[model samples]
Target: MAEELLFTVDGPKAVPARRISLAEAGLLERQHLQQWVIDHPELIGNGVKIVTFEFDRWVSGAGSAAADRLDVLGIDRTGRLVVVELKRDRAPDTVTMQAINYAAMVRRFSLDTLADVHAAYLGGSTTADEALARLMEWAEGVSDETLSPPRIVLMASDFGPTVTNTALFLYEAGIDIRLLRYQLYETAAGEKMLSVAQLLPVPDAEEFMVRPRSSSATQAASRKSGERRAAAAQRLIAHELIPDGTSLTVTMPNLVGQDRDAIRAWLDAEPDRARVRWYNDLTAPVEWEHDGQRYRLIGLIRTIIESATGKPPQAQIWPTAWYCIDDGRTLNQIADPLP
Candidate 1:
């Protein structure tokens, strides 16, 4: 296939903008892409949220390379890990398999580790607990247990048939992999512009693919969300992971600009879907105290998010908000640390 051309119209005079390699625009370095992605992950994929950049902390097993590095790691709204691999030009056929391998490695990353890594990425602009809270805000259901079966996103100027074919196969086989074509355009003023377009899993097809799962799967997931919250609460309190009466602080603020109408709509959607009921009453005790009030971690965050987003927390609030005043780790980190 032939490459597409781009132009800049300056008051009826159209000047051709040459499409070139990322290297030509000084964007081929790993950090160039990593930091840029860390700053603006929206450029990568839909609902993609950047977690950390330059993740390579894994120790090599028998068949793995010791120095393997993941360029950009992110997550989606659903909490699946997103492995973003950046290429300067045409993506090599091996990139897809390589990204899959990185996904396998990242599957082991704990919620705590992600928070710590994001802290380092932030260069101490904020506390790790705050970073974890923000991460939770970005990927609502993200937690140690929620991270799994990572997704892959390949970005480059073009893709050969082999890479696209492999990605298509993976997508159909239940692996969520996507291909993005990036074109680097140089304007007449020496400014560089980037165009990112989805290559595989066409948007309409993707919507069809992302439909509600089989009834069994849907029921199981809905049930799991509720059960997981209860189990985590029971395990934490019973095991004294975080002893009762601990004075916890809101690591982040409550959902400001809360929309009552959206909240009402969310509460009305999908009557049969199971969700852990939140303590709608602000006065109820949650087992953790803030200003002489007892509250459960999940319950408190749910109240906050529901007020803010008009939706049930669905484990979204647990690991993200609220931190121990003494230890500074978020509730979920203490309750569900990675093994």
Candidate 2:
């Protein structure tokens, strides 16, 4: 059972201390708890950010029909997807199976598709691509290819032995899942306190039970790639190329006949800048354009050398830098870190 806090009155003062719950407090309706967690995801656990709520996945076939919906979907800093299932009162015996099914469905989601779901959940405040970029940054460039399996989280006011045993069996069999129990308490002044606890695998058993699989060579390669991407993102942030809230338009002049050393020197002098890509005549840029304003630099040469010479741009002279930024949408979506 989760622990609760109790207050004692001492002459003109009240002191609070920890106290284990002897009996279950009044239950919070599932919808209320869902909304609360949606508003405050940290209540679910540390480093968790709710990506979308009430996600619906249609599962219909020619002869069979079923509607599949997830209560909440989240992702951690390492890009591991979290599938959260919530129950208000007692958790049913089949809850573990239900969460497993949801995890199976969610594990196949690509980065772009996850971003689309998040954008829709945000009511179209930002484009899917931009949201995805931010998520990647938060995930420290943990690439989709290297993302771990989806983690199943079962949250309920209470769990029966059957559900606990089932969860334990799955965990022992190498499924990444956890159970969190929520308990609510009321104070003399009618103030409410909520306590959450991780029940399955307990704290001490986590190290042995949740270690990553043995794929040393593959993991090393993936880590190297992730590090490179993370470094690039950090450089972009440091150089202010990717401003936090405002959109930017970066223009680079064509370096056809320009002095390579001088251009390199100029680029080096710029603070917080990193080389993102080198574009040649054959290299096609994304066709989409920024919506509001168009900024153009005067005397800028626009010829693609590859086009003129019928050859690719020389690696030494390629001159295009790419940076990403949000598009006017507010992202107060994640929980603030615990103090």
Candidate 3:
């Protein structure tokens, strides 16, 4: 079974909002953006620090600068000079020719020309000498023979057929031209989000890279080899003993003698951790008279640890093992346990 309640209501239809014009929109002027860059002007890329943003007249040997509100000129930290032309809505009629003229102007800029531009742009804050020096430094790896070309950057919301065709043609003709598409997004809270929606140099998109595993592996191996070599050196020094009364002399067989001399000389220079022991392999019984007790090096190590720490070690502590002296055959055979 189904039951229903009825209600009647009348409402007026609402009209859709009209699209905003470019002027009505809160789009920032290209000059305003340039000023923003000049103020902060610290563009970073690939962990590199860039410190300058500048503009110059587009066509070389033809003008001082593009007429005001006509075109903008600039250089990035990479020492790459850029010419920017902005269209209010669709592509402007003269933008292609304008950008071409600007590129030509950039070609004429030499060290002196760049210095003049910097001084004009930065005002009394910079001297021509300092600006020229910086330009030379930036030009270190750049070839002096060829006329350094400039990159062309076009900013617009939409491109007309002629502008699009021109840009495409110039790009294929080996001109470094890029189109940046700017878009506006509005939030429900009446907030606007202006963003760079697309860029023409598609392959040069931002990316993140991590260190390769092989590099870490190589570093780890190097560290291990260093530790092993250090351990071997320390063990060689440990096998040597200083001679009695003779501060510069040591008692060691001339066979393993170099380390012994080194230790003896070091001790004479500085008596640190000083001790003396006869050279006897652990396999061969060593008899040492300590407090009328015949203690082997192994027995001495055990007794020292037991008395110092007041704890019984699990294994019978012994001196480090080496081959037997008698036959140099059976290695590290413990003689008889303490009877």
Candidate 4:
């Protein structure tokens, strides 16, 4: 045979293309995608368990052959079932409706529906059915009043508007919905990588879930109101403006061990400030008044410490009395010796 050469009139020869596998094309690694739920089961909403299961793979008694073979099912701690529908390429409009059908089947039939199928298809004994029985037990544990609605976890690399809009609408109506977006990137070495990210509810949901007014903010405002209280207590200790022998209550922030020692030394050096009768850690009414002026020393200390570090330090409360006396001086007059 004569030597022959193949020729093309193209401007440049086409380079050989690398073949991408189904897992690689979808950016799914065998390990990460297969056991994804087991690794982070908490992400399956708050109360759901990622169940290892296989449904009938065919719908019967429904009188319809259009039902899809469910890929996975997750039952929550509350015994409500969550149907998970996965799409490697594109999840179209019908997927949600399809998943809902599966959910309906589970709800209508319960795990008892799987008994015959488990023996024939799964080839597992009744012992293997414990996982399914556990689901029933969990459901029975809940009282009828507190049962939550069934949920759906729609997972895919690319999701269309059909599924997205439906999921959002159902979520607003109190139905639990979780969306998992998977991304695949190909490295220069031809290895595929998969990354999973969750889409959580909107910020407004927090408002409905929480009290309209923030407790923390209310607490902060109270602290601000108490500054004058602390200052008033300081004046009561000095006996500057109060009538003699008048008893008054005062609030003082619990001093730390180190500060306590320093103040004790200062008290020994200069006995100004009224003599503290008995310091009570529990302050009844938690408010103090002296000479028609009120002092919330506990709140003031919190403000000071918080301002210093942008966070309030843990504090203890002390309720003590200040009496007008001749040689009683305030905290300013006493200073602990430098350690």
Candidate with top TM-score is 1
TM-score-better candidate, 3 vs 4: 3
lDDT of 3 by residue, 66-133 (tens): 55342455554234555666555666857888788767766776645666666565567777655543
Clashes of each: 6, 1, 9, 6
Q: What pairs collide in candidate 1?
A: 263-310, 285-294, 286-294, 286-295, 286-296, 287-295
Ordered from best to worst lDDT, the candidate numbers read 1, 2, 4, 3
lDDT of each: 0.64, 0.56, 0.43, 0.44
Residue-level lDDT tens digits of model 1 in 154-248: 88778877777667557755676788887878998998887778877774433333333344553355344423232233335446554434445
Better of 2 and 3 by TM-score: 2
* Pairwise TM-score winner, candidates 1 and 2: 1
Mind giving the per-residue lDDT tens digits that candidate 2 earns over 72-106? 99887556788999987679989998999888778
Candidate 1, after superposition: displacement of residue 222 in Å?
Answer: 21
Task: Residues 210-242, candidate 4: write the lDDT tens digits.
Answer: 224344553455345422212223333333344
lDDT of 2 at 125: 65
Winner of 3 and 4 under lDDT: 4
RMSD of 1: 13.6
